[model samples]
Target chain A: MSALLQVRGLSRHYGQRIGCEDVSFDLHPGELLCVVGESGSGKSTLLSTVAAQLAPSAGTVRYRQRDGEWLELGTLSEADRRRLAREEWGFVTQNPRDGLRLNVSAGANVAERLMALGMRNYSQLRGIARSWLERVEIDAARIDDAPTSFSGGMQQRLQIARTLVTQPRLVFMDEPTAGLDVSVQARILDLLRGLVNELGLAAVMVTHDLAVARLLAARTIVMQGGRVVETGLTDQILDDPQHPYTQLLVSSVLTT
Target chain B: MTPSYNFAFLDEDTKRMLRRALLKAVAIPGYQVPFGSREMPLPYGWGTGGIQVTAALLGRDDILKVIDQGADDTTNAVNIRRFFARVAGVETTEHTVDASLIQTRHRIPETPLREDQILVFQVPEPEPLRTLEPREAETRTLHALADYGLMHVKLYEDIAQYGHIATSYDYPVLVDDRFLTSPSPIPKFDNPKLDRSPALMLFGAGREKRLYAIPPYTKVESLAFDDHPFEIQRWEHRCELCGSAESYLDEVIVDDRGSRMFVCSDTDFCGDRRAEAQA
Candidate 1:
């Protein structure tokens, strides 16, 4: 398959501070890539810059539109960018509240993206939302409940459901399993794995957890100090210590 | 410094500026053109936008009418009419059909407007997406892009929760299939009249500092899901005074025993019907 996204020399800077610099990557259809780094690393900054949520100070992020045309994402008009974000891509923030509409019901959260894509059938919207909730391992009975009523794991699952309901070509997920309990995290990870494989979705996930990258991603990127330190197969990087940062990241994980 | 303002209370330069914006509004059909909205003698919410629009359009030959909640004698409407009379020295009429310019607060007149007339709406909040999205900057970007997903989701959520869109007043509409605009606080019943209108319709939001217009014969659609089409409110009771079943009615508390009566909200229309019945 042709490359879904192409990022070349992408960088984002906040004044004199470096957010992400000299980052280049290509994502194919149905491929899951993970960006792993420490707290101060530019993992999320790189993701946000590619997602167009944050403005980049330098370099270019090229996106292949659904119409077989590749365009520089940096130069797109605000309207075109918003439309592309709604139709072609999705962003899952780390905090579920940032990704989900807190006041609206769970069903509406999943249905909002469909509405943005111009789905006007009320019955169909509700039906798809209900199925997605079930797919996310959420009971359909709680569909009408607001996000406030849901637990942290349930809210995060709902956010995932909402993002994937659009069937976007690419999804940007920031630490999807970062805040959940171990058991809930395992369940969510399994559900996400099933959806990603079944839907043939291309995803760029950011997490500091090596285990998360091992379970979900095929390719992994290691970053330190706002730059890519290592890139390889997930198993290869996690099994062998290549770079000093990658060694520290792999060795720190306690294999019980 | 007590200085006399020009004709209709605005200076020629400001009027010219307003007229230029008004022309652009007509040209674009539903797009909100940003203008330097002037503060009127009235406060922000009391139809200041409508007053400014009327002041810009008023001339010696134009007959003006003002109504609040469809009543010419309502306190706010009466004040506006008195102010226009004192300042512009123009003739005022309560009859909807006779007036060349009608500035309304909430309800559109029952009388079908003529092609020669203009309807100026007193808009408190002009941006339809403001209720769904709180951020002004975000809403402006959405407007610029004609992205109305927030509104659709809000209405669709109403259906998912309540089985119908619960919005009765200030129902959102798409003007010329381009901009989603607020029809002020007018009930959804008046929304149908906005489509293919013979009269030129101008909307002014003084506090929000925006002005918009809908030219004659432009389409105005109420935002709704496909399975759940847009609908207006209906009542089982006919007008108690005019005995008309078709007119929009307002409920009035008649007694201390919790009694109420449904009467025509458009006072002039009700009065004319009553006069005709008596004759």
Candidate 2:
């Protein structure tokens, strides 16, 4: 199948400092890709640039609409961009507080996206939000409860539900399981994997952990210091370790 | 009066900036334009917005009028009037008809404003969705989308709970069918005057750093559901002092008992009516 998103020569710079440079990729439908890099590796910059959250300094990110036409992402109007983020694309932030609207109830956060999509009937919106909460393993009754009241793991799952309830065509997840307990991380990863497969979601997930990449992504790209250093099948990259940074990463995790 | 300050106590550059913002505000009709709010001689909520707007718009020949809750004798009104009389050396008036510029808090004049007059309101809050949605970022987006379902649900729930929409004052209105604006704290009675009036209406919230305008002859709708229409407050008693039944009445306690007497909230209106009665 043709790619759903085409990004070429993408770069973002912060004055004298480099954020990311020359990042190019094509993402297809029903594919899950993981971007693995450590702190300040430009993996996040690349993700945000491609997602059109942070504008690219020197390249293009084109999204192919469902009608089979390519539209330049950078040129979309503010209204159209918001609409796309609400209806077609979902972004899951690393910190749950950043991803979820903390002031509103867990139900409203889920229903808000539905509301942004033009659903007006209160009961129907609440019903769909409740079902999605249940699907995310949050108690249906806790739908009215604020995500702040949830445990860290539950908050992450609620964030997942808020993003996925829109049934977005693509999702950009920034460390979906970064700061949770090992037990919590496992459960969230399991929930995310199940949903992505069942819905045939296209996702670009950024994570520092090789194990997370192996667990979620069919293909993986390794970033180092504002550049993608390696790209290949997840198993081949994780098991063989081609780049010096990838070898060091695998060895450090193996040693620890 | 000693004129120690610049014209209207504002620098020419500041006035020019304010004038530009005012023009943008008039063009947009209800969208709030952010401006650099200056610290004035008065406190924040005590008509700073109205002061800034009046200062920017005041010309040497403009007759200024200031009123608080429809009373020119009130301390806030008296001080604001004294402020302009001293700094700008402009003539001040108590009569609503003669004044070219009226800076008000919580009331519009009983006299219908003319095409030459301008009304500036001191606004504590500029966003109508603010009470419903606390976040400024979210409210901006909501205004952009023209999606006010949150407000509808709140009002609808009020109807479901109380058998009526219980809000009495500072009622919300959709301005120019585009921006849902707060018509300041003016009671809903003054809302009708805002609709298709010949005079230009400007609103300023200094503490909030925002200003907006409703040009002459703009469509302003007080928000309401189809089944439950918008309604203004009315009192049973006529003005005991002026014997005018049409004016907005303020209830005054009598004899420290349950008995009460209603008086006209508009001091000028009541005074005019009493003079005409005596004649």
Candidate 3:
């Protein structure tokens, strides 16, 4: 079957620095693919390029529309990209601070995506925000509290809430559980897994944590030196890594 | 001769209009009052709102501090301070504790403000419901009726999908626990400063032509759900320059290759610390 998202010869560079070179991938609907890489592996650059946050220097990222049309992400105008981002794509950043508008109330933050998509009913928006807060294990009483007052785990959950509120078909998460405690990280990973399964949302998650990838992604891609080193089923890759880099990563996880 | 710009770059008529709007803002605390705004020399979306407020409030006795994203030396802040110095002929200080009036574009000063000091915020859009209900007329009716059903629904949907309320900046709030207000674009980190602040807080939206104020000691609550409350971003790292843990920080790109150093965004706050160390 044709993929929901297709990238062909995708490349991005920051002047002399190679962000990503000759990178390509395909993501199917309801599938969670985790792109694992180290600090300078261009993992973030790849995600940002796909999310239209960063313009690619070369190649194409095409998204299959509901109407069976294929639209090149880079070719779309700014307004068009914004509309797509609001209507079809949800992006979650590594830092909850960058992902959300921290000054707004949690309810406002959740409601904002809907508002951006032109949903105009205050009572309904509040109800939705309250419901989501409960789902994220946040007490309903603090819906009006600013995200600034939230703990790191809660903030990441809120970022997830903000993106998911719109019910976009595609969700891109960059290090969703990076800074949270181990327990919080597990809970968030579990939450994400349950939600993705229930909503049938296609997701591309970028993380350095191999365990996190195994828990949430069906498929895994290992990247090193701004290039994909391996790609396969999460279980297969974890059990029998092909590339030396993936082998090292798997070995390191086992030792620790 | 092309008429040279006024001392502060804003024309006299604009200053007069701002003066009138400011009086009304002061009179009706927490009320967003509208005005017939004039074109300012500065861009409409920039610090024109704060500049107008400063122009109206400037007096020989007052000292001013302007900060953007909490930094005093940011280009925008520097320009604003220079504007006041040229037009108002008032003293400008980089010490947040010493300033009588502060015109801030984004982040609030890190120093705990005194009752005598007043904070003026430059707002891009004053209406909290603008993003929800694009029609100003409809939103006004909703506000008047205290109807906020739409906001709740959006939050609920977020729960259904992501399991949390997602928002980062320009967070909404309940002013006086009644009207929903936008606390400008200050990071959620600074929203706590709005609650019962000793200093009076004013918001001006030049493009939207609105002015609002929160009187000293008034209650300002950020909007949230019972289960999921609002939050601000916290870093395990402290400010590298001032060694201050409490201040808002800007992540500065130190190298062309993306190396970063987090420093206090509030220049006046940093300067005061440096001065204290020297002392």
Candidate 4:
């Protein structure tokens, strides 16, 4: 399968603090790849750099456009990056608050990505928002409620709804279920698994949790101190970890 | 008294136009009413919208409070408060409970506001459909017809593409189930405050030439679908400074080595907490 996204030698740093360095990966069409690491291991940095939220210190992020051409994300101008971010790529932050505009209704949040993609009919927007909300397992009657009123897990689901509303080819999520309760996290992971399989969309998720990775990702890449230490099938890495960090992570989850 | 600028630093004509717009905003609850906006002494992207609204609403008896990111001592807030004190000759207070009218950019005060208070928002763009549609002429038609089909398609697309929606700021909302509006740029954490708020809420976009409002007791809904309704951000992390788990917080970089602290965004709230501790 042709890769939908290609990253080469991606590196980023804030002065002496190394955000991420010498990272490289490829994502195939309809693939779910989870980038797992510790808090300072540069997982979020890699995701942000690919999403074009932060400029990489060095390296290239190549996105396969609909026209069968690859566009270097770093080389694109700000306007182009914004356009791509809005129309072609979706990014969900670690914190649901960071990923959604809370003051707007649930419908508006879902509609915003579509609006960015140039959808304009209100009746159509409302209908689609309602359906998407139902698909995410939220009540349609609460469509107008502020995101602030929803629980942590619900907000993450809503954040997912807001990003996916645009129908972008690729989506990036950073620690999406980090702060949610376990039960809520399970529901979100289940929803994400169902959606990814149903839509056949390509996704890159950054997380510190191995269980989350196992739940939603088919492929897993482990990073330690800003370098990729392990890469393989999610089950393989989880069942028989290769890297010391990966083993530690798997053991830690099991112990707790 | 020596004079430095006109009444409230805004020319009389601008104030009059804002006053007219304010009246219209009050007349139609939760509707984004357009007005002839003028450039202010401050930059367009700053608090020109809230400054204009404050200029229009200022009276001898009115007590004004200006806050940015929910703090009165913030430089922008101080400058705005000074502007009013110098130009309009109105008293300025840091207390949310004391102020008759509060002009805010990016945040709502922590205290529960009374019905007598008025909250004016500084909006960069007033149209909720602008991001979805981009063209003003087309979005106006969408609002006029109460059409929101484009918004739904966007959400559906999110499910199809990312397995979720991917927006974080300036989220759109449905007002009174009739008009779709932007609730300024307050974090999703602040969205619940707009629902059935006792204090009247008004929005002004100086650059966009629009004004809007939500009357007390009016139904304001953030747009969402039934299955994936809207949600706000909550943190397991509490405010380090005020020890407040409920209040909105500002993430602060405390040291050069990257140590971080979370402080209450509302200065009065923090100060009150400090005072209580001392007592």
Predicted model with the maximum lDDT: 1
Tens digits of lDDT, candidate 4, B104-127: 988888899899999989998787
Instruction: Specify the highest-DockQ model's number.
Output: 1
lDDT of 2 by residue, B1-279 (tens): 565789899999999999999999999999999999999999999988889999999999999999999999999999999999998999999999999999999999988999999999999999887866789998998888887756654554455346677776788888998888899999998888889989999999999999999999999998875556888888888999988878899988888668989999999999998999899
lDDT of 2 at B85: 93
Q: Which tens-of-lDDT digit does each residue in B204-264 have in candidate 3?
A: 8878889998888888887666557777788887889878898887889998999999888
lDDT string for model 1 (A31-73, tens) is: 9999999998999999999988888888888888778899888
How far off is model 3, as Cα RMSD?
A: 17.6
- Determine which window of 10 residues in candidate 3 chain A has minimal summed lDDT: A115-124
Query: What is the CA-based DockQ of model 3?
Result: 0.03
Q: How far is candidate 2 from the true structure (C-alpha RMSD, Å)?
A: 5.0
CA lDDT of each candidate?
Answer: 0.91, 0.88, 0.83, 0.82
Could you report the DockQ of all the candidates, in the order they appear? Answer: 0.84, 0.09, 0.03, 0.04
* Model 3 per-residue lDDT tens digits across residues A106-188: 87888877765655555677788889888888888888778899999999999898899888999999999998899999999
Ranking by TM-score: 1, 2, 3, 4
Q: What is residue B224's positional error in candidate 4, in angstroms?
A: 1.3
DockQ of 2: 0.09
TM-score (0 to 1) for chain B of model 4: 0.92
Candidate 1, B1-279: lDDT as tens digits:
123656788899999989999999999977888889987878889988888899899988999999999999989999999888888889999999899999999999998998999999999999888767889898888888878888887897787788899989999999999988899999999999999999999999888888999999999998888888898889999999999999899999999999999999999999999999999
Clashes (backbone N, CA, C under 3 Å), per candidate, total: 0, 0, 69, 55
